[model samples]
Target chain A: MPDAGSRTASIGLEGGRAVTARPTAGAPRSVRATAARIAGDWLPAVPLLILAVLLLVLPTAVVVLQSFRGETGGITLANWAETLSRKSDRRAIATSLELGALVGTISLLIGAPLAWAISRALPAARTAWLSLLNVGANFGGIGLAFAYTAVLGTYGMVTLALQRLGLPFTPPPSTSFTGLAMAYFYTNIPLFILLTLPAMHTVRDDWMEAAEVCSATRFQFWRHVGIPILTPFLLAGWVLIFTWTVGIYGLAYALAGSAPAAPVRLMTLQIGIALNQSANGQQRAAVMAAILLIIATVSLVTYRIILRRATRWFS
Target chain B: MVFVGRLGRGALFAALAIYLLLPLSAVLLSSFATTWTANPLPDGYTLASWGEALANPRLQAAVARTFGLAAAVLVLDILLVVPAVYWQRVRNPRIRVVTELCAAIPFVLPFIVIAFGILKLTGFAIPSLLGTPPLLLLGHAAIAFPFLYWSVDGAMAAANVVKLNEAAQMCGATPLQTLRHIIVPNIGPGLATGGMLVFATSFGEFALVQVLVGARFENVSLYSLDLLTRTSADFGTLAVLTVLTFIVLFVISTGVVWSNRGKRGTAVAGARAMTAEKDA
Candidate 1:
C-alpha cells in the first residue's frame, strides 16, 4: 500500500515528466501546476469527508453529548445514572446480550455446515444456493415477522398442521422470546451462510489432499488444518451476527410488539410511549442509544480484529 | 464413505431448501387461503386478499410514498457515491480504508440508533428540517451509500478508469466529455446495480421511517406492521403486502444479477488488460 502522493508522483513521472520538468516562464503556470496537484490530492476526498462528518460523526456526537445532559440543560451524568439504575433497563441490556450470543451461536451452528456444503457443491448448485441465500439474507424486518407468524403463530399454518398431526406441544405465539429467536434464525442463518461461504471456499482441496498425503485421516485433517484456518473467519462471522442482533429493532418489534425484546423497550422508552409521558425521556433515549452504539462499536472492532487475523492466514 | 458423503450432501440440500422456503411458502399460501385452519394445506385458495390489499387506499398511498422515497434516495446515492468512489479509487487510494470504514458505519450501527441520533441532532441543528421527507431522505442516502460506493468502485477498478481517462484526454476529449462519453457508459452495470440496491433497500426500510416520521409518514413496511399489530388484524392482507414487497425486491435483485452476468466477461477482460498494462 503505497501512499497516494507517492503513487501519483510515480505515475506523473512516467506520464507527464516532460511537462513537469519544463521551466515555467511566469509564476502563473507554476501556480496552476501547484493548484492542479493540490486539487488532484484533496478534491476526491471532500464528498466522503463531508458525508462522514455530517451524517455519521455529528449524529453520534449528539447522542454522546445528549446522554450527559441533565433535566435543566446543564451537563451532567444524571441521565446515564437514572437510566442504568432501573431494573428494566438492566434487564433490557442483559436480554439483548443473551439473545445476541444465542442467535450468533445457533446461526453459526447451522450456517457453517451449510456454507461448507455450498463450498463443496457443484458450480451450478453452488450458484443456485448462493443466490437463494442472498435473497433470503434480505428477508427481514416487518415482512419477516409476518412470515414467521404465518408459520409459527397460534393459528399459523405450521402450528395448525402440527396440531392436526397430534404433536404434543404447540408452537409458541410469535410474541414470545422463543418465537422472536425463531424468526431471527430465519435471517441469521442465511446471513451467516452468505457471509461465510467465501471463506469456506478459501479452504482449497489441495490443502486437504496434502494433509491426507501426510497420513492424516479425514477427521484429523479437518481438526488440524481446516478448523484452525477457519477459526478466525468463524469468530468474525459470529461477532458480526452478534452486533447485528444487538442493534436489531424492527423484527423484534414487529413480532413481539411492545412486549419481548430489550431493543423494543429502549425504543418505546426513547421515541414511543415513554417520550410523551416522561420529561427526561429524550435524554434517557439518548443514553440507551449510546449504550447500543457502544455495544455495536465493541463488537465491530472485535470483528475487524478477527478479520485482520483471518487475512494473515489466508494471505 | 461415498454413500455417507452422498447422504450428507442430500440432507444438507433438503434442509436448506425447507429452511429457506417454508416460511415464504406459508406467507404465500396464507395470502390466498380462504381458510387454513387445521391442515397441512390450505382449505381453499382465493385472490380476495390480494384484491383487498391492492384496493386499500392506505396501501396505495404507502406504495406511492415508498417508491418516491426510494427514488429520491437512489438519486442521492448516485450523485454522492459515484464521485466519492471515483475520487477514492483514482485520485486518493490511500483514503480507501477510511472511506470504507465510514461507509460501513451504517451497516454496523443499527438503523434505530442512527435514526434516533439524527432526530436528536436535527432538532437543535436544523430545527426546520426535522420530521420532513428530506430528513428521511438524508438518512436513507447515508444508509444506501456503502452499497453504491462498493459497486461503483468495483466497476471503476475493473474498467481501469485512470487509463481510460488518460486515453480520452490524449484524444483531446475534455474532462467532462470524457466522463460522460467514456466512464459513465463503461460503468453502466455498476450504476444500475447500485441504483437497484438503493431502491430496494429504501423501499423496504422500516426503522428510519417508523422512528423519524412515523406519525406523519406511512411506508409499506410501517403500514404492514400496523396491520399485523391490530387485534382484528387480517393475516391474509399482511401476507399480500409481504408477497408484494418480496416480489419487488426479488425483481430488482434479479435485475442486478442479470446485469452482472451480462457484463462479467467484459469486466474480466478489462481487468486482465489492466494487469497486463501495469506489468508492461
Candidate 2:
C-alpha cells in the first residue's frame, strides 16, 4: 500500500530537472533537499523500509539465493533434490505436519469453547482471562520447554506423583515427541483463544437474543448461528497454529536437544544438524528452510484469506 | 438450561486454571525444595536453590546483561515501531495492508530461519560484530517490531491520535511538537503496553540466541537451555533459574497488563479494530 504520490514525489525530486541542472552540486544542499523531501513526505516509512530490507527481505533473498547455488558457485537444483530426498528429511517433514495437524485440531476444540466463554464473561473476567492468555502466549519458546520439563520430565514432580499413586501411566519427559506435542498444546490453546476471542464477539449478543426470542435453545442457537459465524475464524486460527507449530524450533530445541539423544522429529532440528555437519550443510539447510517457508507461507496466506472473510461481517 | 450452562462453564474454567497453573507450581515448588522425589509435595523446603543460584556472580552478570538487552530492545522497538504504526494509522491507509502482512510474517517465518539469516548476514557483512549483543539487539528489535506495532496501533485508535493530531495542528503546534507533546503522551498507556510486549519478547527469546550467538553469550533462556542440556545439569539450579525467569516475565506483564486498568488488553485491542474499518 505504498502511497503512489509520495513515492513519485521522492523519486521525481531525486532525479528531476531542478536537481539535474546542478548535477555537480553534490554537497549538503542536494543532500538536505533529498533529506527534507524524505522527512516531509515519507518519514514514517523510512524506518520500516530499512527494517524490512535488512531483517526480512535481504535475509530471505540470501537464503533463496544460497539454496539455488551449488558449492562450485554454479546454479543447480541438487540442493532441493537432496534436501527432499533424504529419508531423515522426509521424516522431519512428516513429523512437522503430524504435529501441526494434531496440535491445531486439539487446540481448536479446547480453545473455541474457552474463547466463547471468556468473550461472554463480564468485563473484569474477560480482562483477567485475556491477561493470562497474553502471558501464556509470551511464555512460549524456551521457557515453555522448561515449564513442561518442570512438571513432566523424568524426575519431574508430576511424573513422580503419578508413580506414587500407581496411575499406570508415566508422563513422558519433555524431551519426547509426546512431551513436545503436549508443550505445544499448552501454547497453541492460548494463542487460538486470543486470536479467536474477537470473532466470538462477532456472534453479537443481540443476534443471540433475536435467536432466543424465535424459540431457540442454546444448543440450537450455537449449532445454527454461533457455529456458522465462528467456523471461518476457527479454521483461520487452526491454520495459524499449524503453520506456527510446523516451523517451531525453539520450543522443540529447548525441550529436546538437537542431537539424537532426545530424537525430536522436527524439520528445524534438521536445519540444526545441517548447521553442524559440514561446509555444504548450510546449503541443505537453505533448501529445507525454503521448503518449510513455502509450507508456512501457503498456510498463512490461507489463514489471511479466511480471516478476511470472517471479519468481513464486522462493522 | 441455565444450570447446565453454569456447570459447563465452571468445569471449563476450572480445567483451564489447572492446566495453566500446575506446571508453574511444579517449578515454584522445586525452586524452594531441598528434595523432590515420588512425593506429591516436596519432602522438605529450603532457600538453598535460590540462594545458590543467585549467589553465582556470573549468573548475576548474565541477568543484568539480559535485562539490559531487553531494555535496549524495548527502546529500539519504540523508536522503530512507533513511527511506522503512527504513519500507517494517521497518514497512510495505503500502507495498512502491506504493514499488516509484515506484521504477520514472524508468525509463519520461524525465528530459526531468521537466526540463520542473521548469522549469514552479520558474519558475511560485518565479521567483527558477529555473535555480539548488538546483533541480538538488532534481531530482537526487528522480531519484536510487530508486537509493539500491534499494541501501539491499538493505542493510537483508543487515543484517537488522528483527531488529536489535527486539533494540535490547529492550535499552532508543528507536526514534531504535535507527536512529541500531544500524541505520545496520550498513547502513554499504549507505549507501556507495547513496552511490556517488546520487553518480554526480547527477554525470553531463545532461538535467536541459541542459533546466532550460542554459547558465546547466554541470556536467561539460553542459560536454562544450557543447564538442561549440560551432562551434569543441576536440577536445583535449573529450577531456581526457570522459576526466576517466569516470575520476572509474569510479574512485569501482570503489572503492566493489569495497570492498563485492563484496557481490554491493548495488545489485542486492534483485533476488534481490524474489522472496525479505519476511520483515518
TM (B chain), model 2:
0.87
lDDT (Cα, tens digit) per residue for candidate 2, span B1-280: 1223777877777778787878778878888888877587788999998889999876787788789999999988888777776665555554555666666667578887887777777777888987788888888888888777876876787787767766886799887787789888988877887788778878888778877777788777777777777788777887787777877887777766565663443234323332322222
**Lowest-lDDT window of 10 residues in candidate 2 chain A?**
A1-10
In the order shown, the chain A TM-scores of the predictions are 0.83, 0.83
Could you tell me how far off, in angstroms, the CA of residue B246 lies in candidate 2 after the best superposition? 1.0
**In candidate 1, how many Å is residue A36 off?**
8.2
Clashing pairs in 1: none
Candidate 1 lDDT, tens digit per residue, B1-280? 1213778887777777887888889999999999987677899999999999899998899889999999998987887777766655555555566776776678678887777778778888888987788889988888878777767876786787878877887899875687779888999878987788889879888778876788588889888888888778888888988988888987887776677773322111111111111211
| Native contact fraction per model | 0.45, 0.36
Candidate 1's error at A137, in angstroms?
Answer: 1.4
Docking class of 2: acceptable
Q: Write the per-residue lDDT of candidate 1 for residues A15-61, one digit (tens) a residue.
A: 34334544564655667787886676557567766767677778888
TM-score of 1: 0.87
lDDT of 2 by residue, A64-100 (tens): 7778989888899988898789887778889888999
